[model samples]
Target: MSGTILDRILEKKKDEVRKLKEQFDAGNESKFQKIPFYDSFIHADKMNIIAEVKRASPSKGNINLDVNPAKQAKHYEASGANAISVLTDEPFFKGTLADLKAVRDVVGLPILCKDFIIDPIQIDAAKQAGANVILLIAAALDDEKLKSLYEYAYRQDLEVLLEVHNEEEMERALVLNPSVIGVNNRNLKTFEVDLGVTERLLSRFGKNHDRIFISESGIKTAKDVERVQKAGAKAILVGETLMLADDIQLTMNQLKVRLR
Candidate 1:
């Protein structure tokens, strides 16, 4: 990706997050209070494929840009998804917290308010936007900020899923000790994907970690899901693959049944 694209994407996200915070503080957002992500697979009787409702990305532009959240969310619920992940960042992803609220009103499942969370204000905004979980990227924060944010999310009864891309990021996530630790297959710097990233992390520390382990990114088929399932991850976070499908519900149901 060009530096221009990356810069523009991040700048747009910053402005969008700022407005989300403002709107949240104004008391005009949905606050759905149910922690379905904790025992998600048990509740659904299948491994999770957290379906994401997103439009664009820095890597791939204008995907599902005109999709309706409320309608799509109903499909996801019907398809046997344990939880829904809404990309709340607007600049690059063409997403918003408003979309999250719309999904919440249309579905009963938990929603993970996916964004570049950097402050407590954003956490408050996520809660207001009806999120049961929040993702904290390991590379985006230091030790002190990570601990503080994790504790804050825990205090608010939100499931914190710390995303780690490599060994050092995994070490940082371990320090925060979130309820869930996600092994992302995409490299942050270059945006290249390799499912081997999950394997390497699981090989070294998967057995030792006390929290729930989730494999994220680079999963495009049932075989990929099965590959990570044996590595001890009961859940996976998939976005682009699911979003671009003709029938997202069918796709999610297939993933859940195959993984089960």
Candidate 2:
């Protein structure tokens, strides 16, 4: 699996981070601070939506290829989305930090810079781009790097959504005592989606699990949202469905009806 699509993506990320460090000065980081991501979900009172702005993906290419991230973010905010998730990977996802900045200039909602973050440079990049939250995939980093990156983001005043794809990864994520834990139902290697993956992992945690549980990926309808919430997820990160909807707000309402 060393030459797998995920592996190649990670290799490219490392090279990009190195080049970014050469060009970016850490002292020149953005002065724009942000609210805590956990607070957004807490105040939402229902299953919060982390509406995603993505143009393409490795699994399903060219989704909304002509996306206007700023415009889409405005629509998501108008539709009562609790937060926004901006894809920042350029090669596979056709996303850039520019997209995050564009949305940041327009919306007050918390924005998550979704990417395969392996190095601290990417964390700094996310901060400089006005991202309030950063995604740290457990499968992508070792225990030491995961802890280091988690603390690095915190030091930069950015919140983290530690993503775990399985029980083993969840165990590693819990070691850091993260404030938020997202169960990603999509397999990174095979790109196979199974919504039950979130439910199964969430069930392992009792009511006392203090971390905010977010179900990510494979969520399609109100019923899907309802299913995850029933399984104990406090939030859901939705992408393609809302992105492809003819009426974004209407689709949001449809998915949120379960909460009401």
Candidate 3:
């Protein structure tokens, strides 16, 4: 509350991490197989969709508060989504690890634990809950923490989606050389969104076949998909638009433009 949204979220995450450490049981293994998250985008001919099961966010108060995580994930899988991203931060996003477990139980597709991860304990918890991938936001962590967490997730056999919003964050993220990199259009600090954020970052770095590029947030239409696709985004992570869609399958299909 004293700082920006990102700062406030990170502060809150510290408390969550402490609680996670208190109750997390590392010996408990996930029942699901660790699906390859990055490879899905690399092999796809069309724009890969990491369809998100997000109930709410700091920016949008409540999108779909009553959505059943398992049922929603099934819809995404049936609609050709490459992966499923489950927002697991309960305080801000109104999502919990239980939602992730529910989605994992129902979908064969790789599941991404979309949370502001600052500690290794969160990664352990995600793995225990059956997440195949975890998000590492550049804005939420410094250089040291970023590298350590990125390495830790790999050691846990979990994929890391290193997310960046600007040129500086992108520079920091590149040092890790993560297999999958996402250009988030939403500024975590301000909560403002712009699809141009993806275009600018990709334009600056150009395309790297070795690293799967994903454009996250603010993508709603085929035109929005094409805009980022032209800028060399191989995949996209969509949340609110799909959550509010009257027809989930049709909305997903519309956003999944063929990769150029």
Best by lDDT: 3
Question: Compared to the true structure, candidate 2 yields what TM-score?
Answer: 0.96
Candidate 1 — number of clashing residue pairs?
0
The TM-scores of all predictions, comma-separated, are: 0.89, 0.96, 0.98
Model 1, global lDDT: 0.79
What is each predicted model's overall lDDT from 0 to 1?
A: 0.79, 0.89, 0.91
Instruction: Looking at model 1, report the run of 10 residues with the lowest lDDT sum.
Output: 1-10
The 10-residue segment with the lowest total lDDT in model 2: 202-211
Pairs in steric clash, model 3? none
Model 1 compared with the native: what TM-score?
0.89
- Candidate with better lDDT, 1 vs 2: 2
- What candidate 2 gets wrong by more than 4 Å, as runs, is 257-260
Q: What is the lDDT of candidate 2?
A: 0.89
**Which of the numbered candidates is closest to the native, going by highest TM-score?**
3
Q: What C-alpha lDDT, on a 0 to 100 scale, does residue 186 get in candidate 3?
A: 93
User: Tens-digit lDDT track for model 3 on 1-260?
Assistant: 66898888889899999988898888887767879988767888899999999999999899989999999999999998999999999999999999999998888999999999999999989998999999999988999999999999999889999999999999999888788899999988888999999889999885677788899999889999999999999999999988989998899879878887
| Candidate 3, run of 10 with poorest lDDT | 204-213
Q: List, residue by residue over 124-234, the lDDT tens digit for candidate 2.
A: 889999999999999899999999999999998899999998999999998888879999999887889999998899888625445689999999898999888888888
Task: Compose the digit string of candidate 1's lDDT tens values, residues 94-160.
Answer: 8887899899888888789988787888888888778999988777678888889889988877888
